[model samples]
Target: MSNTKLVINYHITEKCNYDCQFCFAKWENPNEIHAKRGLSEQLIDQLASYYIGSGLQSTKVRLNFAGGEPLMLGKRFIEIVSYAKQQGFELSLITNGHYLTTQFIEQHSHYFSIIGISYDSQDLNTQRKIGRIDRKNNQLTPTELARRIKLIRHISPNTEIKVNTVVNALNWQENFTPLLDVITPKKWKVLKVLPVKNDLLTISNQQFEHFVMAHQSIAAMSAEDNDSMTQSYLMINPQGLFYQNQIHGSDYLYSPPIIEHGVEHCLSQIEFDLNKFANRYIKTINNSHFLTTNTNIEVNHV
Candidate 1:
């Protein structure tokens, strides 16, 4: 268990395509996110050092890039990915797959051990209802979802694919019958829609589990119920502030920015459970097909 690597859910940017109404990083206006976006190479270095230096000595740190959309940062996102890999860290990325291009995949596909794309439901109407539409000029089509999945697998062949389905009222009842049966992912993360303030999209334990069971046979499943989500990850918002989304009071606890408080201080502020962090990687890393050269990455299943 001491050897299990830490997984950091790093939100690289607030600017996202398809503004989900139940967005955890509830920006007041989605349009203003671009103006608010910033992720310096300096902060990126600090983040890498914190996890790499302070984490288990034998294990390589896994930085999972997420966002309003990490791909929205475009080339800069890849720059950060390169920097982290150079520092002896494993990589993962979460995107809606809207910006996956031939050039982008060819250049940056090797950096990530896993590339996750969010897919809430099989029904197009349900997707629209859950705020999975491009709030800007782009239209969200029914076929676009399937197209993006196939394109990603075609372009980036070796890297492990992971699908994130946030179980909510819109998607819970619908059958998830393996949307990507052709391009099977290494893991299917079935996460419950977190209860936030003024939140309407919610799911019960029964509902969340049912969704996971439906898709569990399709791939390795990481089913995080509300209780399972808390302290299971080391999460960094776009501002470089580390936060924990819990199943308790306020639903979240935040730390000072890694720039201001430093990584150790920021981690201490959150009371992060190292045990939980180790446990999370146990289920997902086995079948990752992760092609990193680093020998330090020990997949501890204990």
Candidate 2:
């Protein structure tokens, strides 16, 4: 009944390759059993089944690969993407761009319509120095990271390659300009860092202030550079997490909380009257912020 299509963010791997202090995932390796461990094929199959059964066949869907680092579950992810394409759906991935390899990209190029790679120069040294706890032996560097982005562009030039960065205290002012210099030619995207509890991505209040200022500055300059493009965008964390959005009155879809209910349930349940998705966004924001603020207040009082 709704003309709006759903962009489903499939959180395949909660395990990341880098232990960046700013990472919000808090992706500690529990190393649990099959169901409890990393993203399992079972979860993928369940998601695929849910999509098919929901009669949301008319829904133009894009399966966004979210992660600790999606490539950590490389082969499995490729298989899922392949399955989705076979069933007539679009697939995309968001990565840290560290584990990228020529062979892997070549193999999976047909699977994904787009690939988003994240990099933050402020956390550059940290990523270089340490390995993600899940992948303890692996470490990534800026040059290597840059090389991956270039290679993705070169190999899969047709594939939409987006460099995604979280603008916060460290890079917002001092280093962002240089980062823009490198990425803007590639037409990369810079996103605002949304607040998350116990998130490594959390910057101080001062850093956040600079981030907004830098964002406004970039928006003004970008208007002159390309009026056709909207550089900043919002993404829903798969658990249906709320992040910041400039368009308060717009629809921002999220997965229904009940995994068994599927997409049709979500569509039917959402009351998109005059306010559209604004109602849902406000509700989520209020709940999440309340919890976050109370937790912080409790911590401070203690």
Candidate 3:
């Protein structure tokens, strides 16, 4: 409900290097989840025009590229970001840090205002226990993650690097002191592990809070509990269709994936809580509000 503009969380790809245990995008055929496939240039253009018409006075829109490792698209991702820029939108991206090459870092660093690295633990044993290993030969250790953080800072001094940690049963009790001390990010977001269709690892509120409080001094920490987590974000699945995640029976329930249905129609079916979305962010980023009437419609942009 930011009066400034809209924020679009788009899952751009489905090919991921690391097989994290609790990955939400546990699709049957991940390789099929390419952004270009579902979101055609025509669709993107229509979306751009719709958003522009909707928010005439709004200054900018934030397009957040997420994944199954969004970087799998490589230069294509940069191309899309450039296209979005041409359409008058700011950009941000989330990555697993596996494909953070020096060349790519130097080339597309300025395309994103913020880049988030998904790092759960600093302990190798914990990482292994949680399936954070490369199916191929090379495994990404915590030291390597730290090294990448430093590399990002050294290369792109202006880009804000945020460390996104999911508090789960595997490493919630472990000390995060050493990791935080090594390479601190601009914003440290501690999100409670959300249950998807198949989540084997999870944690309680007490455990998550304990870990967050452990390293508050490391950076400006913002902790989101399950309830807030559900309502806070506008998440689009790999098929270019937005989804609202919540408990159904034993598994999770996701709304249907259809971009042509429009974001507003799908959002209304899910009864998305706009109030939570409006005030969810607690970082230093300047976030303001839109009138509730405008927000009630939410958005029809894909």
Regions more than 4 Å wrong, model 2: 1-5, 26-58, 126-139, 185-189, 199-201, 204-206, 212-259, 266-302
Q: What are the candidates' C-alpha RMSDs?
A: 6.9, 10.5, 6.7
Looking at model 1, how many pairs of residues clash? 1
* Model 3 global lDDT (CA atoms, 0 to 1): 0.67
For all predicted structures, in order, the TM-scores are: 0.82, 0.61, 0.83
Ranking by TM-score: 3, 1, 2
Worst 10 residues of 1 by lDDT: 289-298
How would you encode candidate 1's per-residue C-alpha lDDT over 1-302 as one tens digit per residue? 55576677877677878778788875343342123434355566776666566653436668888887888877667767787788777889898777776677767777788888887866667777887768564543436666655666667666788878888988787766645565456777767787765467886766665665555455455666665566777787766677886656655788976777787778788857776556456544445221112223222211
Superposed by TM-score, candidate 1 places the C-alpha of residue 89 at a distance from the truth, in angstroms, of: 2.1
Per-residue CA lDDT of model 2 for 35-126, tens digit only, reads 34333334444445655546655355566777677777656566656665765567888887766787877667656778877765535444
lDDT-superior candidate, 1 or 3? 1
- Give the per-residue lDDT digits (tens) of candidate 3, residues 125-232: 887777776777465677888777777777778888887888898888877767766777776777778777555788766676667556555544666667766655
